[model samples]
Target: MAKNSALIEPRLPRGFVDSEPADLAAVEEMVAKIRHVYERYGFDPLQTPFLEYTETLGKFLPDTDRPNAGVFSMQDDDEQWLSLRYDLTAPLARYFAQNYQDLPKPFRSYRQGWVFRNEKPGPGRFRQFMQFDADTVGAAGPEADAEICMMMADTMDALGLAGKYVVRVNNRKVLDGVLQAIGVADEGQKLTVLRAIDKLDKFGPEGVRLLLGEGRKDESGDFTAGAGLDPAQIAAVIDYVGGKVPSGNEGIAELDAMAALFASAGYGEDRIRIDPSVVRGLEYYTGPVFEIELTFTVQNEKGQDVLFGSVGGGGRYDGLVSRFRNEETPATGFSIGVSRLASALKLTGNLSSRPATGPVVVTVMEKDRIADYQKMVAELRAAGIRAELFLGSSKNMGKQMKYADKRNAPAVIIQGSDEREAGIVQIKDLAEGAEAAASITDNAAWKAERPGQYSVPRGDMVDFVRQIPAVAAWMEVNARP
Candidate 1:
């Protein structure tokens, strides 16, 4: 007997997930909807490689303790560190810098790809996930940032989240003014303050106050060393976060400017709001910062009602490209966390619950007549109908129908020896058959209803199947005219 090899258990890395077929289909649908919105705004699609030179990506994240804290990086053969991009914007910055002379100024482009982050993931957070980003590079005005906010709102509405969400806008300069007012001048202390403030949603006002002053120790007894500001400074910071200070008025003014732009564009306060609380936790944003938050609440793992936070956000980074070129090249963009948004949509019942319809299965009645089954499948497919020939070992009619049902097939094509002799084919509407089977009881009633099964000429199989409402409706929308 051959020696048994050690059995290895199949497992995914922590904070990573495997997307099944249905999950992938849902994600694709969301991407298509978002892509349509981006393209409508005249933003071109762009594809960038997943790997970038570590230096090119840069260490912009607020965590400065470890230079490579948030990113996944490894040294290449040439001893140069290459990191999987943590976000799309950084890669876009690198791309723009590399092709600065050739590419169009104010390069408006959208990209959808997987980004990796080496963070301790928890509920709704993952190590690897999809992001759809739209950026307008080389545009310096607040209007460019305003346009991004508008586009973000439109994209959310496009994804069936019209009244269910809001785009909260704020300005880093406004926050900077607040920090200056409070006398938190040091960059490290300022970042710590920003980081603490960013947790306002998770840790409410009192919790944030604790962090702002001394520090916060969670339920797990983990002490997060805070900024250690004095009581007056903490009060100022809290007041700023609450939109109650002279320092935040600059940011408030910027938000008002953006609001005017939105109003002129017919996007009223209903869609977008000037919320000073939105201190986006990114060091790169030098101007306006916005976060898209779902207004609706859903039950968490503990069955507690919780708000879905920050589906997507972006802001003006005037210095990202300037990192490469000495001259200032202002840019602004927004990115939707594809997985988070999709999951939220699903939970809220806003997501399309349409079942994943499979190809119409052409069952093989006889092994010798496989060629005939293939021909039927070919005809259906040629007419732009999704179809497949059953290649299962079981030739049992019942088992074939079961397979079709398992596939969520709209219909099944049948051609037994008797049907073939008559030069015809039987098309059973699996969808309709299942529906009728759930309701109808008697054999006579089933035969009289013939619920979804229909017999048509061999040549007319495609046309006949197309007549089925479920099949035809999908074809009309998906197939070519």
Candidate 2:
């Protein structure tokens, strides 16, 4: 006998999750809506591989405490290093540079796929997630960035999130200019200050002040080293983040142009607005940056009410593609965090929570009648109804019914020896039967009532099954264009 320890445990990695049918359906619905918005804005679909040469992704990895930094890296057969892409934008830059000659000057495209990160997962954070991104390469003007913001606003509206979300816009150059004005010249300290500003909403000004000077210890007593700055430098940084300081930086000019475009399009402050605290943590963002912050509040696992934070954000990376070519290739884009947005929608009751209706099950009544059962299934599918023929080991009627129920099947078709000889099939409407069974007191009365059972001619099985509410609803939803 094999030892129990020899068996491999069925489990998933900590930062990964399995998508059930309903989750897949919700994501599909969201993707379709987002695609519609992107297409309406004249963006075409593009796709890239999951892995790329690690160098091709550039050295800009997200800040993480893990040893691997942020990406999952591996050595290829030829000793070249390859990594699972940390974001869709880097792969896009590589693709555009390689195919620059044949492509149009201002390439407008959208990509949707899974991106991996080698970071610790907590609560809503995961190592692998989906990002739906739209980018406009070769466009340096702030208008390209403005259009992206408008499209993001439209996408939220299309997803029925109107008035519940706000697109906060900012400029990295504005923050950079602020750092220069304060005489903070060290690159490491500059990055630390930018990240501290990004955490204004989470930690408030006092917590950020500590991050700017020395460091702040969390409730868990883990001390994080901060940018060592004098009181003057810390106060300067705090004043800027509090919107107490204004600048005449070029980034400010670009933000002004974007703001004008937003007004011209009638996208009021409620939909999109300029704010200083939106310094996206990515190092590649050179100019305008923006983020979608959900304004709604949800109860956390600790039962405390907290505002749902950013679901997606991105900015211009004029320097990203320049690494591949001598001349600069200005690119601006944003990504929608599909999984995070889906989770928020699920919590707010905007996403459908009902389990997806399964196929119409054709139960095998006789071992010899398997062929007949398959024929019925084929006919139902031909009529655009989802269905399947039971291929289980048991031939018992009770066992077959139990199997269908487990499958969430709408109805089950039964043609026992007597019904087969009579040229008729019995259809048991599981959905209606369950509803009626809840009201009936006695099991005998429930069986006698046979609430949703129907008998029809063998040739009429498909048509009768299609009339069942659950099956008809499924067919209507899944109809081909």
List all candidate RMSDs to the true structure: 2.0, 1.8
Give the whole-model CA lDDT for all candidates, comma-separated: 0.87, 0.89
| Model 2: residues with Cα > 4 Å off, grouped in runs | 1-5, 64-68
| Model 1 C-alpha RMSD to native | 2.0
- Residue-level lDDT tens digits of model 2 in 1-481: 5675577789999999999987888889889999999999999999999999988877787563332367899998899989999999999999999999999989999999999998879888899999999999999999999999999999999888999999999999988888898899987788788788888878888999889988999988998789998999888777777776466789989999999999999999999999988889877899999999999998777798888989999999999999899999999999999999988888777788677898898888788878888888888888899999888899888998888888889999988999988999999999899999899999899889998898899988888888899988888889867
Q: Model 2, residue 345: what's the lDDT? A: 83
Q: How does model 1 score by TM-score?
A: 0.95
Off by over 4 Å in 1: 1-3, 247-253, 443-450
Q: Pick the candidate with the highest lDDT.
A: 2
Candidate No. with top TM-score: 2
User: Model 1 over residues 1-481: C-alpha lDDT tens digits?
Assistant: 4579777799889999988767877777888889998899999999999999888878786587676679999998889999999889988998999999999988999999999999999877899999999999988888888999988888888888889899999888888988887788898888888888899999999999888888999988999998889999888878878877473365667777788999999987889988878887878889899999998998777799999878989898989998899899989998888988998889877676566668899999899989888988888889999899999899898898888888878999988999999999888987788788779888888778888788899888888888887788778768786
TM-score of candidate 2 on Cα atoms, chains taken together: 0.96
Instruction: Mark the 10 consecutive residues where model 1 has the least summed lDDT.
Output: 245-254
